[model samples]
Target: MTETALLPGPAVVASPGDFPDWSQAASHAATRVPDAAVTATWRALNYLCAAQLYLNDNVLPARPLRVADVKEVPSGHWGVCPPVNFMLAHLGPLTAGRPPGSEVLVVHGAGHAGPSALAHAYLTKTLTLTGNGPGWSAADMRALAAGFPHTRAYGGEITPLIPGVRYTGGQLGPALAVAQGMVLDAPHRLVVALLGDGELETGAAAAAWTGQRALLGSGLHGAVLPVVLANGLRMGGPSILSGLDEDELRAYFTGLGYEPFLHDGSDVAGFRTVLAEVFARLRPLGVARPQPVLVLTMPKGATGPEQVAGRRIAGTPAVHKTPLKDPARNREEFAALAAWLASYEPAELFTDRGQPSDLVRQALPDPAPRPRPAPPVEPLTVRGEQAWPLVSAVIRERAAAGSFRLFSPDEAASNRLRLAVSGDGMPEWASEILNEEICHAWLQGYTETGRDALLATYEAFAAVNTSLLVQHLKHRSTRTVTGAGGLPNINYLITSLGWRNTYSHQNPGLVSAMLETENPTVHVFTPADTTRAAAILTVMLTGRDRANFLIADKHHTFTFPPDTIREELTNGAAIWPHLSNPGPGAPDLVLASAGDVAARELSAAADQIAAARPDTRIQYVHINDLTVLGQPDTWPAALPDDTFARLFPAGVPVLLATVTQAPAARALLAARGETARVRVVGYRDPGRPLPAADLLELCGMSATALTAQALSMVKEPR
Candidate 1:
């Protein structure tokens, strides 16, 4: 990688009441941010002037201004130029009520700050921002924007994303606080953030915390513009590779009082629909229930990409096919694109300017010449040689010994840690961002911000490991300890081990110290463990007894049209595919995945079946999906049948749930004849299994009782 370092500077963030509010700042941002908007196919011509100046990574060519050359343009990149294609799809003749321009703020890291330079160039009228760059350069756009066009801006060569005005060189963390401030301070304006997946955890946390606090406190008025180009891997875990998951993602945003929606980062239509929904939601809740949303358009990484220091130890999703990029060719494509822009002439850049207007230009006001940051705080002579070397050496040794893999081992202790610095280097907020809480958020956020597959990695690492440990205990323990309520034992193990009990709630990392590789000695009604078991079961037993409750009406599915409730049951059946089918002979039981309607109609259907076939006995049980099935493979094996005694010792029928074909055709089966009856029944249902009293009479000293065999599998095994 090309050697790089962010030119140190200031900080900023979001959340309500975070900074002073004023009108001038809003107007200045509105005007300056939009000037940088993308205008043409290669990147709208108007915004290209600014986009060209962005410091792009060799991996990113889609963005014009990024200083580094990167061959990628994430959906989040739209904040800067609104991807020419996206704008082309939505920007039709800028009709009335079309706020001067695309109201979006392109969020980028210091390494790619040059792009925002373009955002400021053309997006000024329609969009606004707090400030740009990575780490320290994070700014309070609401505060900085307060001063108006006269507002103090950064100095120096315009970075790709940084405005010539507030050129912090490289800092951007604080900028998030600033943007969030704008949303809370100026609730009416839209808040858009353009971010790569790499920037998600680092920048999003404090901002999210601030946003959540703001919403809970006073409710926010504006929208959160998080455009995550999910790129890399998670920082740590079992081999450490979590891509992302919707359950985790929605839970996180909802915790912040915002509902989340994900789309193909590059799908212009899906992106637009999500954005439109976001606007509508934020507009009404404006401060009443201020929900700052995070729109993630991850440029999924490959199945297993190398890990980055300070990132989740897990792998990132594959963004190679995000419609906006081709990883295979991005390296050269972005570099050449950057070089070509560097050769542009001033005449071609602007209509009136003689010299290239393309150079980083400051639309915002100039700042009072500021002082340099203070010297780094050195360790006192009180300690012998700072011991950092010893600590580093020990850490590396442990990592090599199969404890954990540590990246960037060569980084000096001074740099290995995070530091808070002020405008004048007064030790503003410098400190390691990693903590119990941050680690927890990073884990949960990983799920919420990316894809479903990637999250499986994290879950397997965090929760599954503990679950395996639970399974280990299940093998040795005695007596079924039912954790009645509150914290179950299994729940405790998960939460204690940093697995989230509920997907939402607090960052579970804080409770990491609670993780136990071994079970507790105390047997005092392990509620926590039991609760965890219940939660895990909830995930595993989604479709245990679909047929028991969801039997299709012999002729029709239902009296009323299938609505949301019915859909839930049908969807639940998806988890237990084995339970969705019937045997060969019998048509089906009853159709009832329809909740109350399914339950009532199913009962009535049973009565109808009884009236129609008085000779056959029919009684269906509406067992909840989770309550019924343990394993999809064995579920169908449990259907009770006596007239075909080989299937089950009882005679009954069943109806199953299949979203694809529910109530249309029930699985049909024919089996062995009961000894006395010598009649074979075509269908069987587990719901009508013979009661304990009946089992003795029919089993009559048989080799085995089938119920005993099956219940043995579901019950606590001895």
Candidate 2:
């Protein structure tokens, strides 16, 4: 880690009346942060230079800036750069005096200007701490500057897919939620969240803002200071919040119970002073309540070029991206770009050797050791219909040990998780946010912050967070490969499956979509019974950098014994030797099942085959992991062909009863090169409002249908 201390220095102070109309004035006289402002200006220059490289593929001062150097397709947003740098500037001085080893996290919500974040990290040498050696020099900086907005390099957005990033940025509205999760139980830590003003228009962002109600009076011990980068512009036009005056903005946040502090960048010194004061007042005093603060009125493109091509750029929607794209075609625009780059005076900010000067180093926060990973919780022992009850016991145990949280979108009681609710020996163990997006934000935020947590929701509605799921899975996959420590296994307890609901709720497409990605960090566990679910949850809660989905029913169901569960969980599937009828040789047909209902139906089908056709030979295999049926190379849980053959010999007809979509099952079999021979029966329709038993038959997922399908396949010649 690098040793950097940001010392406060003199700054230019402006009166409240100096700001633009509709912007609020500072409450008190401003304090100066000359050093921090210099660092901020230096970072703003880097961001602008990076944007130029991404758009034109050449730096401003470089001689012979040519059309050939310009990228065919310029990418990356530049409008938000000024605010991103502005917020980070003040954060440096705030963390400067903290004790060594204190935890301070900066979660950037605007990721489109990912290069800005990369630039800031590089300048501070935080990139080096993340194991990116040689990133501190001018040569490396130039290399990094030229690579963004290109698929072959850093890509266009900030993602956990890269080392040192704790949150995902391309997708808007989840950073605050992620921040909330990180601060839980760590009263001494400070989590600063920077959200793009335009992103606040998103429903997820609104949900996350109002959802802070759950944080209040909940005994949480961390501070979340949300800095809204109020740049007033989205991608194509003005944001919804951009039109509101300072009073309206203050009222909006105040209505949500936050003590909003207004800041205008025209007075950067004043803004920094207010920001420091806010942190000082909110620093945890061992309180069990949320400390929420908001910074409003951040101008977009505060200090870049004023205009280009006879069009106003700075502080306008036009600045949302590169102001002068295709610079090779226009000599005047190219000249303007060069002059703009020179305005930052980079030579004064950096030493001749390319490293940041002492002043810059002093303005940068020191990097601490990566947070510790979640400890493994003891496995729960309860089985049978008591599976969920045992889960409640485990929740109590984990919550008592601290660092455990449970979130639901108004489905806890429906999912039979009442025991894990607040109180009942599990204070703060559960929070019902009533909105899937909000719940997902909380779950992702909490896990990203180094704790264990789970979200229970209807299988159908789990798709509400489809966008979040995809990004989170990608992030987890990155964490796994990069050894990006500090993330915990994010578990989704998906119940109220499609089979038990009508058309409105009968959607099992999430599983199929997840399978389509085939992400190694994503695992689907359809445990046979409550006991198996308990066992699966035990392993899931303690796992790291993975998305574990446990699909089971909320109703009472049959369960297999512990012995079989132990053996099957090892390879994801195992034959039920006692129930199988292989005779002295291999069976004539094989029956496999996944999920609670599918397992029961398959078991019943086996009994039907035994009674009606005494001479038939049948082998039964239960699937715990749906992905295991695929080739091992494609899926980490996949069973080897030889292991698969042990249950289904070559030339034998196979019938698989699955709760997932038919396509997903077939896709897995196809990956194993068995699709041509295997017959799959799974949820295939928007079910009618019927009894549970009738619903199964309506979709041909019952024992009678399974038996008929099995017998027909068995009778056919291979």
Candidate 3:
């Protein structure tokens, strides 16, 4: 009995089949291929059919397409059919059986061939292709299409969508979000979802979880869905399910996610049969249960390890082989294409199909050169996505009620700092942070505006976490009433840094800290360097400080006359190689920050410093979290491998130097100094190290001998 079958929550493991693990599947795979002849023929046929189709569509020429040329066409190089095979297996045979007005859809995004061709052929009501010819290789698809009876869709745009069935394109990572929107918008249509191999592993999987929640909320249970997987190799990555650990698989699907129907791609006929069965089972009981059914296929001959043909064949580039194409691949693809299609007697196709054809010849709407530089989105630059009219309620909600409404700064200096250094984290704090980021992004839009401009204002405020440092300073400031009755420059201090997902935690601590703030400048810093300094300066001076942290590349370090800023250390702590920065009789406190100083160390050093500073509380404030500069990890290419297998929408780049990571700042600081210095804390905001009594009190603990004895801390507040 697997844990997934017994319990709920995220299960990291699962069985792959009736068996418990992959050893059984791998062994099963070894026996399925049976013989080499079948594998080779299947591979050849599949490739031949695909290459010819691509060439007829004016994709790769089938002869010599320069790697550069092959790369030119959008979504051309990713090899279509990975997402199409499953769709084709189910929808292909159905083309011949649709009663009048029983419309069908070929839904998918960029690069998918099977769905595109099938849909293209059927809508035109023509036999675009027939797998038969005089010198047929059985792999010939163009000749087959040459025999089709297809008619052009309205206005030759392949649209107005099937009146009954629609083929909508979607991007990767958020399928269910779209599904959610879709279900609400068109409550009458049958929504068939098609996703590729790695789709389930992405953030889009979150949508699946949400969909599950919606199903539960709507009181619809056991809603089965068919999630077909083109079980091709996991491109640029390893094979999924075909080789995943069983327990892991079971945990993932049966427990962590909604249960889905899984199937093999080669058994397309079988897949269709099961889907019909699953759909029939769900239709009557639906209160709108959103659980999806998943289908896995290995395309053609089950190219997965479970199947035979996809063996460890030598990695070789496949060029379309025809009498016209020499093995050298040095000839033009057109010659090869012509020779290949010639076998089918392609006479009319060259006439440019005076009637409707998928290839509309070079008679384009605009053949002139493109305009020089593209015009920009005007006025306020919007992030997230392109702009639309403000008529939508969703847009209104988004624009009006941001995740969190941020306090836009009035002064230039105060604006650039961030009040929340947020990301994935404990819930309350995460929400505050994520909300702040979203609100700031909305205010900033996409582009940076002027000194007092929208994004600029929020950005300025976001650049540094002023509220925190100001609050800390106020808490420690010799004068108890610096901003006595709510200061003019200060707005309500930020209390939480909301997160999107992953690390959400329900913590009452953050909220309590807010309630304890003695002044309007209170904030809890999340150790971002750039934003922290900006926050401090903003709260004190009522404006932002552009250069809070100095950014010096290794080479640029020597470029400064060595005295760009003078440094004079007064007193601090030392490193104990055996224990920590503070070992033996070392002083517990040190006041050091950024650039060769003891600033970016872990909290341990800061804690030691606070321990030593008794008269005042302490803080090892990580000022750098505010700094959004610096890079640590490389992108796995903006578009995932599976995203490339679409037909309408193409994969985008996850550009380098985007997305930031937490710095080993403290450790980096520790390594920089000959001796690690402990942080010194003085009286500050709730975040500062507090006395035993103070700590107990803030956490809602009682004071007194008995309570102290029970808690083990019966001393005065430090």
Using TM-score, give the best candidate's number. Answer: 2
lDDT of 2 by residue, 184-255 (tens): 665655567778776677887788777777665556355667788777778777888888898888888888
Between candidates 1 and 2, the one scoring higher on lDDT is 2
Where in model 1 is the C-alpha error above 4 Å?
Answer: 1-42, 45-111, 119-169, 203-207, 214-223, 233-242, 283-294, 298-718
Over 1-718, each residue of candidate 1 has an lDDT whose tens digit, in order, gives: 0000111112112333232222233333334434332122123232342223222221112234343332233222222223322322222211112232112232333333223343333322212233342211112222222222221232212232122222122332333433443333233334344443434455433454443332333332344444443333322211111244667766765665666666544544355456455544544223445454644543232111223223331232221212223322455434443443444332333333211133222322222122233222121111121222222232223223221211111122222221112122212111113222222222211111110100011211233223322322331121123211111122111111101112232122211212121123111001111211222222221211011111111112222222222322332321112122233543233222322223333344444444544443222333233221212223332223321222222322334221111111122221122132111111111233454334222422111232232223223321
For each candidate, the alpha-carbon lDDT, in order, equals 0.28, 0.68, 0.27
Candidate 3 lDDT by residue in tens digits, 1-718? 0000000111111221111111222233223322232222223323433343333332223433333322112112223343443344333233223222121223332222332333323322232233331222222234433221123321111121212122222233333322322222112222344555555555544434433332332221112233545444444444355465445554566564444555654443355455445544433112433344555644422221121123231111121011222212433543343443344222222222212222221111111121122122122212332111111111122223212122232321222222222432211101121222222322221111111112222221333333332322332221222111211122222211111101221122322233233222232222122222222323222222111212211111111111211111100111122222332332222222232111322223344333543332221212222121111111111122232111001211100010011122222223323112222121112455455446334432212221222212212221
Please tell me which model should have the higher TM-score, number 1 or number 3: 3
294 Cα displacement, candidate 2 (Å): 2.9
State every prediction's TM-score relative to the real structure: 0.29, 0.89, 0.33
Q: In model 1, how large is the Cα lDDT of residue 131? A: 38
> Which sequence of candidate numbers ranks them by TM-score, best first?
2, 3, 1
Candidate 3 is scored at a TM of 0.33
- Structural RMSD, model 3: 22.2
